[model samples]
Target: MELRIGCRRPPEESVPGLLRYRIASKIVKRQPLGGTDDEWVVIEPVYRAIELLEQLHDTPAQEALLIGRFSFNVRFKWFKNWANSEASRRLGLASIPDGPANLRMLRRTLSLEMAYRPGGVLATKIYMKHIAVATTEGCASRPGGAQAELLAEVNQHESERDLHLVLEEFRNYQEGVLPAGPGARSLTEFFAGIDAQLDAASAAAPKTQRNDRDVLNLLTKRAKVLHLGPANYCWFTGPSRALCLKLAGTPTVDRPLIGMCGSARCPQATHHSGHRSVWAEHADRTKIFLGQLGTTRKTERTRLQADHDRALRVIAGIDSAIAIEG
Candidate 1:
């Protein structure tokens, strides 16, 4: 920080670089002391205040040289009083927040800002799964993720770009192209109901604004509510709560860790034909791996077999849904 004085001084002090004291990055100016002719001596008090804020969060006895003779409570109280002074109030700056704990809130905000950047999802994937870093987990397992709620608000907006794609898929689904996951069965009904509701709403009100695009807005709300994944749909309107291992023992109802979803067995999970190719590949890979496994690896074999079976079941469900639609 460079503290400047309005009063005239030596010619060398004209340049800020020539100043004897330089610490943090801010601009401070000296002014009158308590409406008197005496100078307030802004440099020392403000510098110490900034230092106390910087190093005092984790410990009080930090930077003895910078924060000389300043106790933990007295420094903060002095700063707060100085901030409320008539001259300080004239600056119209927001008061400095309580350090560390309040500043940690920034980490949570940074998580949001970072997650929405150009490659935020891929970049922040590890951070989201981390126990400490805040993120909205679909596989996420955040017990009470405010981050998840923020993402929902974000997705509600950006998902608009893909609404037409969802409509196109719904309109021209394949003969056996079913949604994937256990919730697959309800997808067709939900779409149909949405259309019917729009039609009825338009008829009942006559002037009510409604279109396929507008009708599909409900999907955005549903997506937010169910924590829908981009690659999969959630037809979770029935008895099955969730089969995510993350939610197994937790008491609080939070975002389902969609990454850990029991896709085939979970009652709420559903995949559409869009996801069929991936499921097919997964099943095929597991089948090939099963062949590669020896008899001694029973556990591995059993796990692979279970995965294979789940994939097949999910594929079958998709086909069944599409066939029913036909």
Candidate 2:
């Protein structure tokens, strides 16, 4: 069986949503009476109706066609299960991952058009936000809810994933594919020795937990590890010695802020080949911004020049010696 959502609504079915929905939506918007905002009454559902569709005309904005008006999340799980089923295997599609990206990916594939997209990671957040009814900064957490504990648990698993990536960099260092980072030679040696065992232990953990915490604990004595996502690595031992933290004058922070990183002078930052692209892009962006600045903006140009130079230094240091701003 096949499911197809037409790109354009049939001519006879031009208006997709009820007029009542548009009226209520306009009322909810609380516009000044008879304002321009009164036009195009908004259509919001429990889940996004237009996310996977490339609708060309006024398709009922709130009425989803796929799988009988269910949320995309529910439909996504159903597709995932189907994809992994024996039928899907016989159809030669057993290897497709059940990852989040596959949800709209399948839709786009079936619809035969590229999905409307912004930045990759940024777009994912936009999609989630679009599907949600409302988003408020203050509504981010609840003191009485289990959400905080769940978030902490999620952070632990993410940390392990991040550590494993750093370990991969160390493995490359061991193979002479890269050079050592900013740390005592003893600590660097410790990094090279145990990445494999920890990885194995992580693989052996129960499927429910992402990694074995016991395995991760083995690095506590040697590797003062903090994975700085795009910036690079920080073998952070103390905040007093932390350049980024000290520059902020916030003594409470025991880590690099990446945004305010002064890795060129810091003693704890490190870089590897994996961080080259980000530093290089930073240099490129700074150079472009500098070029576009007017002659009168000397102060801005001076700061940008420093930033560009620092980025270049970080790039050179990735395989060689500033601070991996990351």
lDDT tens digits, residue span 1-326, model 2: 11123322322324675322222111222346542222122234411343344243245344234333356777767877888889999999856564576545653442222112222222322333323312311222212223335467888887766667655655565565553345434345665567566566568874644343554466544344564746666667677777777888886875567787665566776666767888888889889999999999999999999889888877775656223221
Compared with the true structure, model 1 gives a TM-score of: 0.46
| Over 4 Å off, model 1 | 1-180, 199-210, 217-220, 226-231, 235-240, 245-247, 323-325
- Tens-digit lDDT track for model 1 on 307-326? 89978887786666666654
CA displacement after TM-score superposition, residue 10 of candidate 2 (Å):
15
Candidate 2 lDDT at 38 equals: 26
Clash count, predicted structure 2: 6
* CA-only RMSD, every prediction: 15.7, 18.4
RMSD to the native, candidate 1? Answer: 15.7
